[model samples]
Target: MSHFPMDIIESLRSISRQTGLPIWLVGGTVRDWLLGRPAKDIDLIVPERAFEVGQHIADQLNGTYIPLFETVETARIVLRESKMIIDISNFRQKMLEADLFARDLTINAMALPLNGPFEPAQLIDPTNGHADLSRRQIRAVSKAALQADPVRILRAIRFTAMLGFHLEPQTQQWIAAEANRLIYPAMERITEEFFIILQHDKAHQYVDVMDKLGLVRVLLPECDRLRNIEQNNYHHTDVWAHTRLALAELEAILLSIDDLFPTHGEAVRHVLKQPMASTRCISDMLKFTMLLHDVGKATTQSKDADGIIHFYQHEKVGAHQSRAITKRFRLSNTETKFVQNVIRSHLRPLGLLAERDHLSRRAYHRYFRDTEKDGVVILLHALADISATRGKSNWQTRRQNLIDLIRQMLDYYYQPQPNPPLLNGTDLINAGVPPGAEIGRLLRQLAEEYAAGTITSREEALAFVKQAISPDATTTPHSDI
Candidate 1:
């Protein structure tokens, strides 16, 4: 417990001294301490008056005391000073041992009393959790664990992904048996837990695990439909197999992203590491988006007179279709829009194959302007698709050509071009334009001109806007402060 602030522990010990009600630091707090990991939050169990002691400790630490559950009288103390959280609660059962036994996992069932010095010898491991920790396995405290709360099914896999631990034999059986109950939890909680697993280094392996455990059937039933759908000769496997291959290939590509795009290694890493909506990293979202990229194929699949299969405008169809799933998962609006945009534009890189050796400036302009530099991320996803498709004998040649095109695309995207418009609403309003959508349209037009090399100076921009707004008149640039 030396990892924790001494003052906070002291306050709890003082409370015990005065009230004479036994307080124990239980569950994850004790487990994390044993694992030598720092604690961000601790669970405390007291005989009674959880709110009173929680408020006192909050005041002692200058934190806020928020009452949680009125029946159990659970209260939370958020300490900004140490960036830690302390949750005080009355025992769920009559005693600490019963409360510990009632927990989800054995590793999280350990505890230590706050009345004395912190020592491993003081640990209350009623379930032999210490041995399981040594084994790096997650074992449920009882067979009724999953039945008590179906959400723990997701939590069990989450621990495996987070800690790189395996499930004990019986625990695995319980998970496989109770996997469908995962659909019963609140969608937001389920989404949050799924995002955590996607953040793992090799999430595809766990995706395979989820598939085998039958969780995928309940969580992503659409995938079952994709399994029966076959693909054209450009792909050797059916759509379902290719989808799994895509996820695995994408993970490999991301891990070696620096080597693949050596010159822009750090730039690509920075974009992927950025947090998207709900505070999930862009890298995590990429996996989800990639898996669903071809989902429209389920409905759009067709065959021509030659029996060659085709998925016409699947990108557009997929973007339109994925809305329901995105909404179901409770993704933030910003995240939803991003996923749809990627799905719509995923085929842009391949479409460039028919163009000349060097792409036009306007071609780059439209893609980057629409995506707003997020095209860098789209390029990575496109490369993964190309890598996963190995049906053609000349696949390497096609892949190389696409790689060259991407390098050129990224280079053009990163060039030191001047910031667009050279104008703003203030400048426009100072001139003759009103403060509304018209100003935005004119600015967008000016930005387009700047990108296309049609206008080079503020003087030219003023003339172009004046000519476009009123052909008979000329306007001057804004100068006075």
Candidate 2:
């Protein structure tokens, strides 16, 4: 209790005295407090009437009361001013020890009295949770804990990563034995936990641990298929290994983005920090794309007549596959399209590199236009992918080149357009071009010409459209454009 802020402790004590119900600070809140971490969310277990008590607490504190779980009689009191949340719930079992035993991890199976005077000695650790916490070990309360709730498996891994604790041998065995049950959890739950893992700085370490525990295959079969798939001589390792290294390198680059691209580092950081949908950050989405960027290679692997391995159009194939995967995870439409677009156009930056000298302003415009705000993300992923593939040979030059290219792209994207569309749809319609798909196609072509410095004014655009619509023109009008 001494670990908590005095205001929270006094408020809870006042609420307990008013309600005349014994309240206990339970679960993760207590665990985090003992570990000296800031706990924003406070969980309170009461003997009964959890919702009623929660409402009273909310009213007394002028907070908002929300019924979180009606059937379970759980409610939440949000102290908006303090940015803290108090969750009140009925005990799962009649006795506190029984409730603690029903929890997933031993380290979390502890509680402290909230009504009584603050005292560290009042902690109730029925499963030796204090010892485990001191040892920095993650152990299950019981063998059936994970079997009962498969989501706990992911939670276990998350805690392992978050707390920098190793799972006890017995706990590891239980996770391995119950690994198949991970599929039972809702996709939303799995996705939430997966991205949370990626949000950590050492996400690559946890991902490797998840792969070793056999959870990766269940979650991403496409990635699993790349396990032993060989690549060309340009790559030092298999696809799976290279993918892992790319993720690690991606983290490194993001951390050091300031030094790499000093001109656009702030913009890049802002884009990465921007929220995608509700549950994921742009950086998390980027990491996910990096992991799956080459998944299509497993299916598209081939050898030419000269025995040179080729993964032609793998990015195109991977984009389609990533859509299905993102959909399966029940990600928002925005997130789904973001991941798909990044996968599809990941190779574009490198393509730009190849044609750097000849690439027109229109080409850069079209690249950014197709990729949207995710263009920077794709550029960073490409840098990581190229670095991992090339290994230790002159990677600094290549990396610096990619960073410079990204800086140029960012500058181009942020810079004011040198040529806004010289002609719009209405202008095209007035120019004798019928109002239909052809008008839209002609408008795009005119804009492309404008961007390419081919046409500078409305006269040039009308002339181009007239020539495009003429019967003497040999090339057919591109409706798809």
Candidate 3:
């Protein structure tokens, strides 16, 4: 009746009609339907004989069945058309109360009955879910309900952010009291819920709750130390706050980028905007790189004789520290490698721009060699990182310049024109060259000259190689030092 697939609803209706039992489409699907959201999943509850009803539905459609619920009889049947698992459970206990009591939040507990044709559809409101839905409040049915599944503490924040609802004062107090209970939940479960929060429109609000609940410190203890750490004149906020701002900016920019390209036109937008889900955004590489980008500041925070602060070699220090942290988190070798590359090349954006005037072929080779597949990803990360900085140092002008340089780098990166080798080992070996370490060294020297665009092809490479090996090399490669 609500624009759901007619065949599937009819399948359910037929099964209910044959069984001679009242069936109610209960829980989230009904809730989401009332909220005017898409409801792909449906749950059906019968007054009695849930297993028999489930078996009947399965037989009608030849679908898989699974038995659940310890006290009340409950089973699941996969519908043929929608392929949705219609959870079939019995309405047990004296008060028709299990439906509301079984759910975490009041708004999710409402149900819609689909019984005999003569009987009108009834809205089951055992827990005052209708009132809560109207008020836009996420309140637990009872205190015991909150205690039964502590993960609702996190879900409450997620729902609050996603639905633009507010937690009742009592429910908020309960959440504060039960925040520690989240530790008992499995990491996989926590991660699933956390990602759901991230997917929401205002996920940062959920994270803010997590921070207030002290769960962020529990989740990412490494960042806890940044809370009070001073960041010198260059930073407007403390390190932790800066990190949070960066993450917020990153999310905002990504969402803006996502909006610029509609879902249907995503393929066409690839040439203009980098795909949002590239290794740069959601990968563990991004997470670890973001975490460690400022980590070396802790170790390298130094005041010179002039009382000026410097974080020299912070990138190098952060790379090693990131590895240790990654190992502790039980990340895979590939993940660690990616994170390490991001950390190591974190400073390359600034370095690249520093020498932008005389961009050499050798510099391009070195840049490509270091970044590999993550070249573009690292550049994007750098853009986000630089944009995140709160310092007032003409960064607006500098940031735009860096963005242009990165675009040019991306152009060369995607283009297929071959980079002819300046000098090959074979060239040295064929030129009556001695079989010594000097030959390899001389080959590298010739390659450098080629990278400087001083030589273009094999003939030029041969000439350069021969000149370097000649005895009158007074005006040498590393000259005028």
Candidate 4:
């Protein structure tokens, strides 16, 4: 609601009357208005010269113009006061009726004339979109509509999740008949619609729907290979099924954050909302990473003498295998690195938390020190991974222990050391110490000692450093150092 500019409609109509160019509010704007939902963005269509018209309207309203002049002759305006976006474009097929028929969905084909008074009678419904809206269904404008743009198939899926609408049986059959058309569009276009689906609240459920609709096979063929791959005794389902359940559990964990992590829930939630790439936030990445965490287990499966299964270093192998997937998706360097790190360290939390009774201050320090900002994400994935393992193990006890481990780790992560860092590389070099890895080693050691409450002041830290680098002292720390 904050993004809608309430006073701009008159200005737009005034400009339209003066210029004699009929601008109609089309697509989602009109649909949301008719549905009694607050509009976040606006879409308009003109007879022609959309780029120029869009810029002229922006200038008249003191808004900023974002040129989207492409094959469709589109441009955008960001209202300075409300910060809402308006996308204006030329009619797709040169006439309003043709344009409406060319659209993908009936619900989106309606347009209201901006030049006339606002009224329901002024609405243009070519494909009986109003009837479809009343029925809460998504029906294609025509079969050729999808044949014109296969990417709209993804939009149909997104609409079902976002608007809580169902695709009619005929539309579903059309989608099934040509599901492979999804692969023809540019990857960027496919990703645009794909991410909208992924960002929904029920993404876990709809993603499986996408798989069943035969779209996932065209996008991620590797997923089909995960089917029926068996796992160790700790898992009740096969690899693909467990992966889906893990994704579901991750969403459940996020929803139940207050119960699972009462004190640090909000802070952890805030971190998960950060943007990892242009289209994906940290939460999206977390869900996606869970889907690929055990990809290496298929190649690493082995049976010991006791007939027990083992997947030695599958995390490492999975990490190595994840690059190709990231590259195929054209993920940015930051997102690619994040996915790799999560797969590489997905098994760390349990191993580190297994010794909670004798857990060293150095262990806590080293784990967070090594992971830094990624620790939160890694720990959340660990919980989901273990939560999905509903097999022959002591499930309830392990679940409690994992949750407690997450609480302790998050506490250590949020609670800073009582004292500031005592020594820097410059100070170490000034003290005749070498300027290299040893300085880093000494600083890490000091951080651990500070965590342990053994080193407090600058004087004590300097003496420890002096003793650490001395010829006779046999000083060692955690392996991570």
- lDDT by residue for model 3 over 279-307, one digit each (tens)? 22243346435655777767677788988
**Candidate 2 residue pairs in backbone clash:** none
lDDT of 4 by residue, 1-481 (tens): 3434446766888888898888998988878877877788889898888989998999998899998768989999999988878899998786899999989899999998888888778989989888898999999887788988999888888888889988789988888787999878888788778778878876888888788888877887766677888887889998889988998899899888888999999999999999988778989878778878988887888889998888899899989988888877777889889999999988888888677787866677878777767888899999988899989659878988999988987887888555446888898998778988888887877888888768888999899888887889886544531
Per-residue lDDT for 1-481 in model 2, tens only? Answer: 4446568867888878776779998898888888778787888998789988899888888789999897779999998678688889998888999999999998889998877766658899999988999899989998798999988998888998899998888888888888899788898898988888898887999999889888899999999999898888778899999999999999998898898888778988999999986867899989988899998898998999989788999999999999889988898888888888988888888888776766667877688767877887888999888878774577667767777777887787776554556777887777788888998777766666666677887787778888887888775432221
TM-score of 1: 0.86
Task: Please list the residue runs of candidate 4 whose C-alpha ends up more than 4 Å from where it truly belongs after superposition.
Answer: 1-6, 14-20, 49-56, 64-67, 70-73, 476-481
lDDT of 4: 0.84
Best by TM-score: 4
Q: TM-scores for all candidates? A: 0.86, 0.90, 0.76, 0.91
Q: How many pairs of residues collide in model 2?
A: 0
RMSD per model, one decimal: 5.2, 3.3, 5.6, 2.7
* Superposed model 2: Cα runs more than 4 Å off: 1-5, 80-83, 391-395, 418-421, 456-481
Off by over 4 Å in 1: 1-7, 14-19, 59-62, 354-356, 419-481
- Weakest ten-residue segment in model 1 by summed lDDT: 472-481
Q: How far is candidate 4 from the true structure (C-alpha RMSD, Å)?
A: 2.7
